[model samples]
Target: MTNLRFREDGSFRVLQMADIQDGPNVLPDTIRLIREAIRKADPDLVVFTGDQIRGYDPAYIDTFLRRRGEEPGARVRAVTEVEAKLRGIKRRARNRVNNRLLAMKSDGSNPDVQQTASTASTTSTLVYSTTSDPQDVPTTLDELMDETRDKVRRTFAGFLGPVIEAEVPFAATYGNHDFQCGILADEQDGIYREFPGCLNPVDSLEPGTFALPIEASDGSGRVAMSVMMVNSGDYAGKPEENDAQYPAYVVNPRGLDLADSDGYGTPSPEAIDWLGAVQSELGERNGDGKPVPAIAFQHIPPQEFYDCLKEVPAWTPNAVEGARTHAGHCYVLNHEICRPGSRLGEAIGCADENVGEVDALREAGGYFALFCGHDHKNAFVGHAHGIDLGYAPTCGFECYGPKSRYRGIRLFEFHESNPAGYVTRMLTWGDLVGRYSSNEVRVWFEDHCVTGAISMRNELRRPQVFAVLSGAMSLGFMAVIRSLVKKR
Candidate 1:
C-alpha cells in the first residue's frame, strides 16, 4: 500500500472526483475531462467518491463486440437501429392516441375511443420500459461474469489512465450503481486493488470503509491528518432497513414512479459506529491520544443536508425541489448557515432515514467536514450540527450534471501546520478546458447543448425524453386543427 503524507512544503492536495458512471464504452470527452483535471490539479492523491462504472449498461455486450474488433461505426449503427425501432413503436402508439382523441371530440360517447386510449397507454409503457433482457445476454453465467470484470477493468483503465500513468496513489468507494452489473461491492473493491496506486485496504473496517493517515512533512513519522472513505450502499431494500418509514413515493405522480423506490441508500448504522472506532484508532496512532482532525468522503450525502437547507416557495429563485416528505416544495441553501460559494442545482436526494450521522461525527470529535457526490449537480458546503457538509459535483459526463461550465471536480488543500484548516473550491469544466476551445460558438454549443444532452441515451432519462416528445406531438396536432378551422 502506498503511504499518504504531507509534502515537504507542508502542503497536501486531494482531488475528489465523483460519479464517473459510464460503461465500457465510456465517452471520449469524459476521458478528456478526467485527464485534463488530473494534469491540471496534479493531486497528491485521488479519491473516486463512487459510481465508477454504470453497471446497468450492456457492458458485457459492448465488451464482447469490441474484443471481436468490430468497426466502431457498425456498433453505433446497431444501437441506433434498436433505438429507431423503439421510436417507431412510440410513434405508432402516439398516432393511435391522437386518432382516438380526435374521434372522441366528434363523438364523446364512443366506447371504442376509450378502449383505444387504454391500449395506447399500455403500449407506451411497454415501449419505454424495453431494456436489455437478462435471458437474451449472449454469454453463459461464468462467461458473463468474466465479461463484466473485463468491462469494469477496461472502464477504469480508460478513465484512470492518467492517475495510473502519473503514479498517483488513489482510493475509491462504491456507489449504488456500481454493483448493478452482478459483481458485488467487495468484488469491485478487489478489482480496484489490482491497479497500481490503489489504497483500498485489505483489512477494511467494514467491507467498503477504510482509513488513511497523512503523515507530517517534517519526517516526524506522526499522523498529521486522517481521511476516511465509507461505502454508502446502493438501495434501501426495506423501509425498516435504512430507518425509512415509507417508500420513496407515497403519492405516485402520473401513476408512474420515475424515482428509484428507495432512492439512494445511506451508510449503515454499523458504518456510523465504525467512524468512532476509526477516530479512536487514529488517536492511538498519533501517540498524543488526541483525536486527529479529519475529512470524510462517501458516495451519498447524509440526512443532515436537510438541516442545512431551507424550504421556500416553489417559485423561489435558485430554489430546487425537495425529496420525500419535502417533495413538491423548493429549497435553497439556508444562507444563514451555508458558505457563500455553495450551490444547489438539484434537490438533496438523501435517503428517507436520518441516522443522526452528523451528530455521531461530532461525538467522535475529529471530523471537520464531510463530502458526498450522488446528487450530481449539487456542489455546496453548509455548516450544520457543528460540522460542514459539502457536495462534490459529478466529474463524469456520462450522467446528468450542471452545464459544462459548472460540471467539474472538487479540490481540498491542507497544510501540515494547520491540518484542520484547509481551503476548498470547485474547478469547473470550463475552468479547465475553455482555453483549448477553438471558438466561442464551439464552446457555447458544448457547454449549453452537447453537455446537457450527453446522457440522452441513459435509461433513466428515456421516459422523460419520451414525455417531451409526446407533448410536442400534442402541440403539433392542435396546430393542425387550428389551421383547418381558420381555412373553414
Candidate 2:
C-alpha cells in the first residue's frame, strides 16, 4: 500500500547502501557486493545508511574484564591471551562451517544435508563452537550476548540474503553496528519484514523513523519527493545542554556512551525531534500541494556535519584543517577532511542537544538532504544554508576504505517534474571489481553531487533555453576536438 506516489513522468531511482559490516558471516565478497549493488542500481528505492548489523564484540567483554581486573600472573596471562583468541575464533568457525557445508554438498543445494555428516553452513545453522574448556573466555556480558546471537542471526541472514534475492525495494537505518550484534533493532526489524520490497515495516514509526511518499502519481496532486528513514543510533544518549551556536559544546567526559567496542549509534534528541516531526509532515496534506523534496537516512552525523565544514569549497580547507584536535577520541571538531580511515570524526555526531533538530529541519520545507553512514572514509557533499549534507560509500569488505574511491552504491535520479529536483550517482565496487569496468562509478560521483537538471524538468525552463543549449554544446565539443586535432 506504499508504492510511494509518483506518476507525472515520475522516474524514481534510489539506492544508497552503507557501512554494511555484515557480521558473523556474509562475505562472498559481501555477497558479490550485494549482487553488484542490485545489478547496477536497478532501484525504485533501497537505502541503508547504517552499519547493517555488526553487533557483538562487546570489546571481548570489555577487554576480558579490563584485562581480568589485574594481578595474579597478570591475570593468567590475560586469560591466556583471551583464551587463545577464543580458540582461534572457534577454529576458524569450524573451518568456515565445513567449507559452507562442503559448498552445499557440491551444489546439490542441500538435498537433505550430508556433507560427510556434520551440518553447519548452507547459509549457517550457527554451529562454529568452542568453550568446552579449551581455556574458555566470554566471562559474561551474558556470555558475550549468548555468543554473538547466533552469528547475528547467521550474519543477518547472510546480509539480507542478497537484498532478499534481488526482489530489492528494501529499507534500513539503525546503524552503530545495527544494535551491536546481539541483534535487536526489534530483532533486526523482524528480519527486515520478511523481505520482498519491504518499504519500511513501520514498527509504528518514530524510534528511528520512516516516511516514503514521493508523489508523481497515486492521486498525484504534485509532491514528488520525500524519502527519510534516519535512526542514527549509537551508544547511549541523554545528552542535553550546549545551547548550540556555531560549533561549541564538548561534554562526553567518558559518560554513558551507549555502545562501543564497535557498535556506533547516535542521532538523539529523540533522533532529532523525530526528524522535525517528519520534516513538518511534508506539506499539502502529505500529498503534493507542493514543497516536497526531501532525503535523510542516518547512522550518525549531525551538528550540521560540523556546520558543513565551513561551507564546502571542496571540503573547505579540509574543514579548516579539521578545526582543532581530537578530544575524547571521535566526536569531530576536527580531523576528517578527506578522512582516510580508522573511524575518525571527533564529534558533531548528532545527539548532544541536537540543535533543535537542525532548527526543525530548517523550518521544514521538504528538507533537502542529509544522508549518512558514520564516516567510513567520508564521501563528502557539505552545504548548509539551504540544507544538504552527505556521506555514503562504505560497502563493507569489512570496513575502512579509500583506494581510488568506489565502495559503491549511492545513486538517485528522481525527476517526475522536479518535486524539489534530484540527481546523484556513485555505484562502485570498482564497478563490480575484476576487469577494468566502464562508467567508472559515474566518473566518481561527487562533484558536489546534487544532480537533476534536465532543464530542471522540461519547458526549457528558460534561461534563454539554457543559453542556447550552452552555446550548442559549446560548438559541438569544439568541432569534435577540432576534428581529432586535425587528424593528429
Candidate 3:
C-alpha cells in the first residue's frame, strides 16, 4: 500500500468505504477484501463513511421474549405488531424480487433462478440466526448492551485487524443506519465504557465532529494534512421543538435514538463547539502563514445557501401570481434533507444560523474539502462556499438495486508543491471477484441469489478505475441456467 502526503510536492492517500454491514456470511470475505484494499492502498488515513452495522430490531426481540415468558397478552400483542410489520417488509421485499425475476425472465435475460437459489444458500449460511429460541432474549438493557457490544467488537476486530496490525491511522463518521442499528445510550457512558477508543478522537469536541492530523510526503518534503469528520444524521430535538413546529419528525426510520429525541439529526451544540476549537487551534498556527489543505469527512452533504426574493406589490400589480410565475431559486436548500417549499426545512440547522463550530472553521479559511458517503450512488456536488464535496462508493458486495453502478473509494493527493490544488481518483472493486455464486440448492434455500443482482445506474463523477474483475463468471453461470429454462 502507498502512503500519501500533502505538500506543493507532497502526496497523501485516504481510504474511504461505505455501508459495510458486517453480519453472517458478509463479514469474513468483506473484511478480508477491506483489509486487502487498505494494505494495497497504504493510505495516510482510513475513513469509514457509515452504515457499519445493521441496527437491532426491537420488535424481533420483543417477539422472542414474549414467547419465552408465555406473556400472551401485552407482550404477545407488542410482538405480534412488530412481527406483522417485519412480515410486511419481508413480503414487500420478496414481491419486488419476484417481480424483478419475472421481468428478467420476460426480457429473455435468463432469470437465473438456480444461481439465485445458490447465492441465497451461501448468504443464509453466513448470517447468524437469531431465531433459535424466544428464551434467549434478555430482559435487561445491560444484557442487550453486552450482546451488542460483543457483536460490534467481533465485527470491528474482523474489519480492523489489517489496519490495526498495519498501524494505520483511521477515522469514521456515524451514518443514520449505524446510529439507528448500533448501540444506543442516553449518555456517552456506555461507548466510553465499552469501546474506549471506538469513538473518534474529536467525538469530545461536539456530538458529531472528529478530527485527525496527518503528515504527508511530497517532493518538497513532508507536509501536514488534517481530517475533519462530521455527523449529518437527521433528527428532532428539544431546541427544535420550541419553534412553532413542536411536533417535528423525530423518528428516523434509519438512525439510533436512545433518548427517543425529537428533531432531524443535526450536530449537537457541544459538537459544534469542538469543531470551532479544532479549527481555531489549527488556524492560529497554519493560517496567515502559508497555504495548508484540509479535508472534511461526513455521512451527509451540507446545505446549499439561497436568498428568498421579496417582491413589491407596487412593482408588480399581480404580485401573488407574479411570485408564482417567477422561478424562486434563491433559497437555502439542503437537497439531501428538505424538499423545495416544504415546511420541514433543512434538518441540519440553517447555515445562516451560526453553528459556532462550523462557522469557526469557515472563518479560519483554509482550502478544505468534504468527502462523504450516504446516498450509495456517487456524485460530486460543489458547495457555493468554495468547498469541494466528493461522495465515496460502497464496499458492500451489493450495489443499489440491479442497475446502479458505483463502488469505489476516493484517493486524494495533496501537496505543498501544489498547495492551491489537490487531485482525486476513484478506485473501484469491479474486477475483484466480479461474480459471486454458490450451488443450486444453496441459492434456493440459503442465499436467494436472484434478489442480489447488481445494479448499474449511476456513474461515479470522479476519475475511477476498477481493479477487480467483474463477477462475470458467477453472473454468467446464472445467465446460462436461466437460458436453459423454458418460459411458461
| lDDT string, candidate 1, 323-396, tens digits | 67567666778888887778776667777777777888899998999999988878888888888889988877
- Return the TM-score for candidate 1, rounded to 2 decimals: 0.73
* Index of the highest-lDDT prediction: 1
TM-score for candidate 2, residues paired by index:
0.29
Query: Deviation in angstroms for 340 in model 1?
Result: 3.1
Which residue pairs show collisions in model 1?
none
- Winner by lDDT between candidate 2 and candidate 1: 1
After superposition, candidate 2 runs with Cα above 4 Å error: 1-49, 52-54, 58-130, 133-171, 174-190, 195-211, 216-218, 228-292, 298-345, 348-367, 371-386, 390-488
Number of the candidate with higher lDDT, 1 or 3: 1
lDDT of each candidate versus the true structure: 0.69, 0.53, 0.43
| lDDT tens per residue, model 2, 1-488 | 45665544667888888877755666566667677777877776678777666443322222111111111111112323454476454321123344334434332356535543544433333233444656543232333445555556676577667777776667777765465333446655766665566776555365456777666665744455778887765643222221231122112211212211122235556656766565556564654444467777777775567654433222221221221122222122223342232122222344443445556676766677777876655666655657767777677665434432356667777776764457676667666675322333432332122212321322132345456878999999999999999999
- Candidate 3, lDDT over the whole model: 0.43
TM-score comparison, 2 vs 3, better candidate: 3
Query: What TM-score would every model get versus the actual structure?
Result: 0.73, 0.29, 0.55
Can you give the lDDT of residue 216 in candidate 3? 44
Q: What is the lDDT, from 0 to 100, of the residue 39 in candidate 3? A: 60
